[model samples]
Target: MKLGILFSGQGAQKAGMGADLYAALPAYRETIDQASAILGYDLQAVANDEAKITQTAYAQPAILAMSNAIINALGDVLPTPVAGLGLSLGEYSALTASGVMDFNQAVAIIKDRGIYMQTVGEANPGKMVAVMGDDQALIESVLAALQAAGKRVYPANYNTFAQLVIGGVAADVDAAVEALTDAGIQRMVELPVSGAFHTPLLKDAALQLTTRLAGETFKATQYPVYSNTTGSVFTADTLFETLTKQIISPTYFAQALQKMLDDGVDTLIEVGPSDTLIKFAKKIAPKDVKRYAITDVDSFNAVRDLLLAEGKEA
Candidate 1:
């Protein structure tokens, strides 16, 4: 079975995500230490802080460092990843894993990206909500109605077959949620993000990031890295443009996974904290394919042993 690497995004982060890995593995410790030095703060300390970890500025780089450290620490035991895919901000980590960039470059830019997004968020003061347990057409109509009414709400992420992350101006988002609730929608849990990510409201952040991304050097990829904006393997030449557009466009994660599946990625492995991407993968992945996640020490050992065993057999 071919193995595909997955990276988790902002909301998937939690307190103490990579601390165990750092304590147990020298590689992890070095990787985290390297990232911390570049970031001008202790990466683990920032992630461990309850309040800091949730803030966009801290969370983005924290998750990137944690995820990249785990992948880097795994070394040759990982059996040469077949492809890489990440949710939103995780895409940068995926690129680092694929050799498009190094860990230091990724964390530095990711921190700046987060700060820029937060800046735009502060200026706009928007909101995002997960629209759950509703028909896709119905949800689309709801979003379309909001647009027609000039309320500014839109579907920011297409996470699963049924779940959508909606983003808009705070009051417009609130009004949209209220309307959906009154129209028999059962769930619309507001995300605790600082801005309306992956929506037009973040256009300023996207523009700022475009200039930042242009300065960074990117190498050719070792394997396919799917784009959240186009939901397919992105052109390396246009990488910066694709990533910039991703900030203001809806992330077609469901479609991205489908494209990976179509290309024969059978065993999906989540390389960061929590199973948020795994949960979304399960919703769209075929029943026959397998799924794994490497989060803490135990999970790391489990997937490591399995990969080592698979390696021995081959």
Candidate 2:
């Protein structure tokens, strides 16, 4: 039975995330404790408390901690061998799972990344908005119109036929949404993000991350790991560079899902706080594929039962 794991990015985080895992699994608590020491912050509070969990500085580390904790828990209960992929910041979780980065290093990097992104967001003053029921051509037309008007905006995520995200200066995003609405292109909703991520506006953050990435060491993965930058398998030599570019590059989650389907991934398990990735994958993937989101004890048990049934059938 071939299984693929997907990790959710930023925006999927919520208060009380991973508290169950921390309470039910000693390993999860230990992992969070070690991450807290490395980050010099209270990871448990960030995960359990609403105020702290919403801050970009705290949320990034909290999400990474929870995703890694889930992977650790799965290691004890599920098969060790499986393919992995992550969206945006979730890519760090995928790297750690693939053995390219250790848990401590991954946590530290994401903490720094969150700080850098927050800094850039403040300096540039940008925002992200989600556009539903639109095609790429319509999005491109809106972007072109914004550019013509001396406003910088671009597509950040191609989530699905029903969902896409645009990022740029707040005023420009608002203008583009108005134009799209007038044209009856799509429904645009403002996202609760700090800045224009995965766009040229984040070049400063990307440059800083490049330097940090050069100093780190990455190991080859025992299992295949898909990359968000290219929606392709990552090799050891290109892993760090690809990860660096991903900071300023739009995530190809839709393409990655298609690639997993082509690779015969019969089952997809999303390991994180939300079911967003699994839900998106189900909408985009072939109809025969099975999907599951293991966010809590009940969901994990259900996935375990399904895997057992598949094994028995095989």
Candidate 3:
């Protein structure tokens, strides 16, 4: 079966994410240990510490490590994915998985990326709000009007057709929230993040990440991987710029998923913690396209058995 892998992004991480898998699976354990070595500390320890896991610096690498561990745990039976994509921070994990970058370099870069984003966010003091509505046109028009009226709000993430996020300076975001509320939309939730990520407020963070990324070597990808910034597969020429722009741009995740579905990915798996991306897939993908989110041993086995069964059937 053709497969599409979706890696988890930040914000869904919790304390004790992959402890069970680490204890039970040797390959998983080995991968986590390698990440811990590259990171110069216990990656699992950082994950179990609530305060540390919540911090952006620790969370990004920990999540990437967890995603990689799941991939390792899948072992040789795992089918090569035809394509893959990830939300926000998870893009680095996808790149690593697809062989565009080494795992060691990816982990190290993500650590610094978290630090840079958190530092810049603290200094700038902005906010993000998830706007819940099906009317993409209305949401864009409202945000555009606000922008024209000197409010700094921008559409940060296009998660689904029904839901998107907006972020900017705190006051401006609050104003946009009010405006949307007045325009008969009331369901807006402020995200618990330190920075207005995926907006121009994080431009400094993006610049820092660009400089950090320059040191690493990026190889040709094994298979197509969708770009969150472009809502299409990443090309060799556009990889670097797309990665940098992803920091201060709206992530077209819905568009990316549509592209994957259109490209004939019959099976979709969300790797790493949380079922967030899978839920999004459920909304966007056809019912016949098998979708599973593998966060732990049980979920992993379920998907493994399904794939093996499918292979036997074939």
Candidate 4:
């Protein structure tokens, strides 16, 4: 049974995400403690407190901490030989799991990254909106009209054939939404994010992160890891440099999942707060592939049972 792990990005966080894992797994608590020491902030508090989870500075580390905690807890039951990929900010957690970056370094980098992005958001007001339903040509046409009108709008994420996200200046984003609505598009919800992530507006943060990443030590991965930047698998040799590039590059999560399928991955597992990635993957992956998400203790147990049942069937 070939397995793959997916990590969540910025918007997937919720309060008390890792509380169960921290209580059930000693290693998880230890990992959180180490992260708190490195970050000089209580990671557990951030996970349990909604106020802290909403702040970018705390959210990034908190999400990363939760992801690491889940993976570590799963370690007691699952092996570490699976392939992995993370979405946007989740890419840092993927690197840590893949052995490209140490846990503490990953935590520190995400903390700095969150702070930088928050600062950028304050300087330039922006917004992101998720557009659902399948109308690729229509969506493109709407975006083009917005751009032709001098609006700073662009497609930030191609989540699925049925889902896309656009980001840019607040006015431009609002205009894009209005245009899409006029075109009869429903389910256009503006995300709660403070900045236009994955777009050129984050260029400054990306550049700053590159410099900080260069100072960190990255080891070769023992397992295959996919790159959200290019939607391709990376070896131990190119992990660090590719991770640095992933900061500014748009995440090709859909493409990455396709690549994983092409590579013969049969079991897809998302290790984080939500099943968003697995949901996306199931929409696009081959019919024979199985999808699993380990978001909380219940989902974790469900996945274990599913895997065991599959084994018995085989």
On TM-score, the leading prediction is 3
Against the reference, the lDDT scores of all candidates come to 0.88, 0.83, 0.91, 0.81
The digit string of per-residue lDDT tens for model 3 on 1-314 reads 99999999988799999988889889999999999999999999989998999988899999999998898788767889999999989898999999998898898898899899889989998999999999878989998999999888999999988889999999999999998999999698999988888999989999998998786778999999999999988888999999888899999999999999999999899998899999998889999998899898899889889878877887
Give the TM-score comparing model 2 with the true structure, all chains together: 0.94
Which residue segments of model 3 deviate by more than 4 Å?
none
CA deviation > 4 Å runs, candidate 2: 80-82, 308-314
Between prediction 1 and prediction 4, which has the larger TM-score?
1
**lDDT tens readout by residue for model 2, 1-314:** 67888988898889998877788877778888989999987788778888778777788888888888877766545665467888998888888887889999999889888888888877987999888874778777878878987998888887775788889888888888888888787467888887899988999999888887788888888798888789898998788789889878888888887888788888888988899998899788887787889887777667767766766786
lDDT (10s digit) by residue, model 1, range 153-255: 9989999878999999989999889888887889878987888999999899999999998777889998999988888886777797899899899998888
Which parts of model 4 are misplaced by more than 4 Å? Answer: 80-82, 182-184, 235-245, 304-314
Backbone clashes in model 1, listed as residue pairs: none
Candidate ordering by TM-score (highest first): 3, 1, 2, 4
Between candidates 1 and 2, the one scoring higher on TM-score is 1
Answer with 3 or 4, whichever has the higher TM-score: 3
Candidate 3 C-alpha error for residue 2, in Å:
1.6
Tell me how candidate 1 scores on lDDT.
0.88
**Clash number by candidate, in order:** 0, 0, 0, 0
As for candidate 2, its clashing pairs are none
Per-prediction CA RMSD (Å): 1.3, 1.7, 1.0, 2.4
Worst 10 residues of 4 by lDDT: 73-82
User: 273, model 1: CA deviation in Å?
Assistant: 1.7
